[model samples]
Target: MKKKFLVMSDSHGQNDLVQEVIDKESPIDGLIHCGDMEEAFGKDLSFPMYFVKGNCDSRRIGKKIPYERIIDVCGYKILICHGHLYHVKYSLQDLINEGISQQVDIICFGHTHIPLITKKKGILLLNPGSLAFPERGYQNSYIVLTFSENGIHYSLKEVMEY
Candidate 1:
């Protein structure tokens, strides 16, 4: 069976945008939010959702959510984080080290508000950017991971704001 997951981050309190994405991408097997949500948005979701607390998130929310999470999907181990804890704006060494230590196949994070997809030391690094406040010269974007018997495939997608 094929499984699909929508990966997003840094919504920053824009629940409308998050809803739009969910509406447009319905029927997904799961959703992964890399953080900076600024609000709890998964209460009504019908599918499985994973989340981490961002530096901008409130203390109360932070108390409920973790700073990092490791999840297994379709036999692939994925690390989800907000990036601020690892100082991603400065470098990815810490995050990479963590992924390696966790033996994850992919690491998803957000903080720089810049979308990125790259492979480092055989682990895929993905950042979905900011849905509400993208960095200069970058568009609002997210990622989709499709897992099948063949393998895993990923696509970086731009949010189509109407």
Candidate 2:
């Protein structure tokens, strides 16, 4: 069986934009939010969703949401985080080390609001950027991952402007 997931991050209270992305990418098997989703907590969606708390998230809500999560998707282990705890803005070594320790195949994080997809030491690192506030000249973006018997394929997608 093939499974598809939508990955996004740094929404920062823009629930409307988040909803827009969910609507645009309907039928996905799951949704992953790397966080900074100030207003997105408790919002309902059609698909199964996983989330981590970002630095910008309120302390009250942060208590309820986890700082990181590990999940299995079609035999692939994925780690999701907001990246603040790992100090991603400085370097990925911390995050990389964490992934290694956790034995995850992929690590999804958001903080810089810049989209990125890279591999280090056999682990895939993906940042879907900011759906509400992109930075460094990048447009609002996200990622779509397709997992199948063959392997995992991904696409970096830009949100369309109305």
Candidate 3:
């Protein structure tokens, strides 16, 4: 079976925006929030969600979210993290090392507010950017991933496009 996932990150405190995304991307098999989400925003989710704590995550929500986690879906190992621990703003090397150390096939992280999808060495690296405050000339964006026995397929979608 194929699994569809909606991936978002750096929502910060924009509940309305998050709600908008959720409503637009409904009927998804899973959801992923890379980090910096407010506690209240994550409480009422209706789908299976994998959440990580961001550097900007509030103290109240800090203990509630995990800093990092590994999720297995469709025979693929995915590493989800906030990217601060690996200093993503500086370079992707540390993040790559962490992925290799964990033996994951994909690494998903957010911190620079820049949307990106690339293959580093052999592992896939993805950053869906900030849905609330995007930087680096990038628009507010998210990702939709389809995972199956063949591999992981993904596409970047702008917030305005639904």
Best by TM-score: 1
TM-scores for all predictions: 0.96, 0.95, 0.93
lDDT of each: 0.91, 0.91, 0.87
Candidate 1 regions with alpha-carbon error over 4 angstroms: 60-62
The lDDT, on a scale of 0 to 1, for candidate 3 is 0.87
For residues 1-162, what per-residue lDDT tens digits would candidate 1 score against the true structure?
899999999998888998888888777999999998998884577789898989988563658688989999989999999999899999999999999999999999999999999999999999999988999999999898899999989998899867
Predictions: Cα RMSD each: 1.1, 1.2, 1.8
TM-score of 3: 0.93
Query: TM-score of predicted model 2?
Result: 0.95
Candidate 2, residue 86: Cα displacement in angstroms equals 0.8
Residue pairs with backbone overlap in model 2: none
How far residue 131's Cα lies from its native spot in candidate 2, in Å, is 0.5
lDDT of 2 by residue, 1-162 (tens): 999899999988887888888788888899999989886556766678998989988563547689899999988999999999999999999999999999999999999899999999899999999998999689999999889999999999999898
**Per-residue C-alpha lDDT of model 3 across residues 19-97, encoded as one tens digit per residue:** 8887887778988889887554745655688989988884857576789999988788999999999999999999999
Candidate no. 1 TM-score: 0.96
Per-residue error (Å), model 2, residue 54: 0.4
